[model samples]
Target: MKKIFLALLLGSPLLNFAQNKLSGVVTDSVNKPLKGVSVFLPDIHKSAVTDETGAYVLQNLPSGTVKIAFSFVGYDTDNRSIPINPGENVLDIQLQPSEFKMDEVVVSTVFNKLQSQNVMKVDHANVRQLQHKGAVTLIDGVATMPGVSQISTGTSIGKPVIRGLSGNRVLVYSQGVRLENQQFGDEHGLGLNDSGVESVEVIKGPASLLYGSDALGGVLYFNPEKFAPAQTVMADFGQKVFSNTSGSNTTLGLKTSTENLKFLVRGNYTTHSDYAVPDGDRVTNTRYNEQDFKTGIGFSNANYSGVLRYNFNALNLGIPENGISEQTHSKTPDYPRQRVYNHLLSLNNSVFLGNSKLDLDLGYIANTRSEFEETATPNLKMQLNTVNYDAKFHLPKFGRWESIVGIQGMHQSNTNKAEEFLIPDAATDDFGIFGTANYEWKSDVLQAGLRYDNRRISSEAHGIAGVEGSFKSMARSFDSFNASVGYKKNLGKPVTIRLNVASGFRAPNLAELASNGVHEGTNRYEIGDPDLKTEQNLQTDLNLEYKNDHFEFFVNGFYNFVNHYIYTAPTAAQIDDHDVLRYVQDDAALYGGEAGLHIHPHPLDWLHYETSFEMVNGKRKDGDYLPLIPANNWNNTLRAEFSLKNFTDGYASLNVSHTFGQPHVGAFETESGGYTLVNLGFGGNVKLGKAAFNVSLNGNNILGETYIAHLSRLKTDGIPNIGRNIILGVHFNL
Candidate 1:
């Protein structure tokens, strides 16, 4: 975190060229000069390759303590923490030859540390690779990662599920700000698309200390593309087509940057017809249309730097029922559609102090969502607006310790304007203060944090003289304390271990405290408890990893216990032709783990083989299984990488996934059968005149297997997921 802030401070008083300019010499273990070694500073995306003389120079680096990584092919990577002063820094580095792989730099940690340096586990995915797999949506692509899944209504409506948790339990961040789109609803989707996003990072466990409430499950961080490198301008355009849905997607983007100023803008439009099922039947009213626009502007100079960004999105989603319409390839969506528009704005600023720095982020979001069951008129409409901010102070470094003190808060309001009211207009306020510390010594790293929060919720009352009304005047307040500690240490040259313990709490949401009617999506009569207590949880995690050049293996496990767990179950009653269910509290436990390995085998550097498995089990204190739990799953991949003379780097892969049947069933919950899906994909870059183009073709569900997923919201409707589909895509930058 300190490095990120210092990098922005530019030429602040704390920086002096004579002290900050760094020059280094590289050599092999035996003191022989090593040419072409990569010297990189991940925080600012600065890098240089050693010259023939085994020397590298990084000029005008910000004044602060930063981590530098040295990498080269067929050699062990080396890293060091160096204090950047206000004057010239001359240092020499030496590398060792070994059959070891280099670790990636992770920015989601805020400190910009390498994967091997963090105590917590963060799963990362490359959006470009996902696109190569022919995924239709961002969630669809990321679900392929271990310990992650998606709850889908159709091809267009999907929500990210982390360790069997979705909905409000998971928090989504984009444009460097927390996204607030009506997430409490079961059918709500991630309002924003993957526009301008370069990569994604998933935290598989509770992260309430960094984000606030709603992060009790985990955090999904989407990092946008960095500005076109200094003194460069670029434009990119691409198109994609999906076979099953007869869909077409078009996108265009442009970016430019000077030594001190940078700007970017992008726009995308997509249209898809009803998707076909394995039985050749098309799901009616499942077609959708979308439009997304994003832009950013940034400035940096001597004392500080800041970036401001804005995003706008519009979507037309169809509401599916029991009818299956004839397959159609029309771009116009059918009736009974939902029209949603979202607007997001954010600003991030940083300033450098003598030996430390400060980082601040502010954001505002407005989401207007409306649903029309039939006709052109909307039957239900809701608007949500939120404002939030975060500020952190990086303390001066002391020996091997680094610390940060911060405060976070948000204000929100929700209103309804429609013929029917599912919830009352509400207002909410929240505030939290916390501090965290990190230390690195020898081959071990330690991290910990504590936070205290206060929340207040209230809503206007709707009363009827005699007939009926929605909610009564209400107000509720909750306070909680949270903490986490973690440690990571290297066991040997090729082995590493990590242990972590964290406590998290969630205040009851408005729906869990005030709902008093039927939820059409789930076909259930719902009721809320005003006296429900806050949900509290504690989790312990352990991870072990071993890696060497061509082979890698890792095992990650966790046990979580939750008090006052909130859930809804049937009371053996019916109302308005719907089942009756009430939100209840119980003590529960959830435990699971993930293990994986990747191997290239000796003398087969271009050929790779990988296998991974993930499982989770949840039960109440009374020994009842939880609803919507995912089944055990495993995946394997066989890939090959090759090169074409003066053309590009080419690769191809076969991916297979098998899900085991789930027999653990809760009251009134149906069991699901296991299934398997296989996919094939290949892609590569090509030289087209003076430009480089990416071309790929992928087949999803190539075998056309018909089966239902355990977590699909449409499973109860007897609707099978998408069938065999082929996708083709091409893109180029000019």
Candidate 2:
């Protein structure tokens, strides 16, 4: 990593260029200046808000073709590609008025584009938007997206599931790098806090062509908060409280930026008591607390820009054992709990070379996980360290075509530090090279990409050989070639259609290949299969969308086929009084779709109605249903937006969600019953002269419904999910 950084530094001289300036005016369709319109350049993390005259200026910009976005409430967002020269550049933008929300630029994809312009459909949501919906946790907010669900142990422990796939099959990206935190275990959760995050983007189908192995299911990308605008200093404080869990989340942050330098820091603390059910009983040992710190520094000039970021997170998550046996409001966790520490550091750099650019990202992650059972010393502990690197080169445009080539790789190691072990000490390596291109003509757009990846894994033997709780030494290598193609066309002025096909693969993880011990979290003794082959899948997606002045509608469908799909099944045996399960492979298929619509009456623009339905089905070639598939869901909401005398952006909403009974079950799994839930939210921005603040009040499960989600790990134990939670939040900017 040092050598690579040094080489790039020495080559910077050749990439330098003259700085440019940009000044713009924004107006509405009626030729009236629109005050407070936001003008942003995502590539350089620079932004400006139009003044009373709708004028904005940005300085010290690189001389190249850059993408700029202009947005305001109740207006159609506009994205344009502007070519910068050596001196001053003047541009004017005219935005169209609409009742619909503004679309955001998606960063998860290779080429950053607005949702309406991308060939592939992606879901984008801001953290503030999710918070307004009364989400208790980051994962909870993510599960609200259509076609996404979670395998949750409690309110604090959640694993994302996309289209019936979870675990290592899905990849997560944070701070412009892949998050490595021992994700193979079912009880593991996303080790991230939403305090300093800006937004999230979801790619719902095979993304291996861009991310490589482990993207067979999908990708979840988190975008960190941007630096303060140039020549500005900003500070903010936010707090939220929950009733059911007696939980509180507090965050404080400060950021400052100069012409060519920027710095920011944020700290967050979260604590929750054992959650209560409808019967007013708390699930024993279901509490958790977290402490998180994030900081970043950035430097930019005319030709080069770089940002370095670091995050440290410490968590104590209590493992639920007895189901609804105790009632307490204590925040501290008891025995049989997990203590995890994560350290992540990343550096992202971009160099402009005339019309082309080079981008480099390097990351390092150290994760320590310990499980304590009945004693001060941990019963199981593991340390995982990973280093990742990615480099992408954007070539100059060739007429109506644009292209990029990239290389990516990772080196990882895992070691055991406690007496008992679930998996052997292992080392893994990965390498991949890919190239993708896009062609656009009139209202039609086409995109294609191909990639090749190689992964090697080696492990050291552990425990007594031939013993029931022993693991044998092993070495294995897997290789695959993947490809993806997508096309988008405008069927008419108000309609568009998109189709995409992609292939992806996932190499067997260490636990699946070498485990031979009891997994206390699941209360089962698991055995691994070293002969397991790579899991490969091909997926096809189709999407259609229609939008007009007062109404919008969309429908999306997908089908995926997998080869050598790996799963665990129970055997007619036992180990240490625990059921014995063995890993196995079979061919499988999954199909799913989502449909949604939104309407706003012509004169009653403040009144809005929305509804969506999502469904998925998975089965093996032999006709057995897949385990952990989410139940079909239908959600409806009625919302009102208004600007009161002393408040702006005020809104209220009522939502009703219904989940259908899941009758299709795996061989050893039981069916789940259906249920309905109602939720309410109310919030607004309060303006007090020159000072302003935001407040929100949201209630989830307002009906106090007692239910169990089909994907809950505690479902088999007859544990009901949390009920009747009310959340109150306040945020202030200073």
- Candidate 2 regions exceeding 4 Å error are 1-18
Residue 325 Cα positional deviation in candidate 2, in Å, after optimal superposition: 2.6
RMSD of 2: 1.6
List lDDT for all candidates, in order: 0.81, 0.91
**Top TM-score prediction, candidate number:** 2
TM value for model 1: 0.92
Highest lDDT: which candidate? 2
- In candidate 1, clashing pairs total 7
Q: What tens digits encode model 1's per-residue C-alpha lDDT throughout 1-734?
A: 33453354343532432225788899988888889888865444445678898998776566776568887865767776677877688889988775434455666666667677788888877787778877898888888888888888888888888887778888999877889987888878887677678888898888888887888878899887767655668899988899999998888999987655678999999889888998889888788999999998776543445777889999998877755765676766676778889998887776656578777888889999998887778888999999988888888889889899899998999998887667779998989999989999999999999999888999888756222237877899999899999999998878999998988878888888877788857778787777888888888989999987678999999998889888887787777787878888999888898999999787977888889999999899989997777889999989888889755668898999899998986765689999999999988889856778888889999999998898877778888889999999988886
Candidate 1 lDDT score at position 188: 84
What number of clashing residue pairs does each candidate have, in the order they appear?
7, 0
List runs of model 1 lying over 4 Å from the truth: 1-61, 66-81, 87-102, 463-469
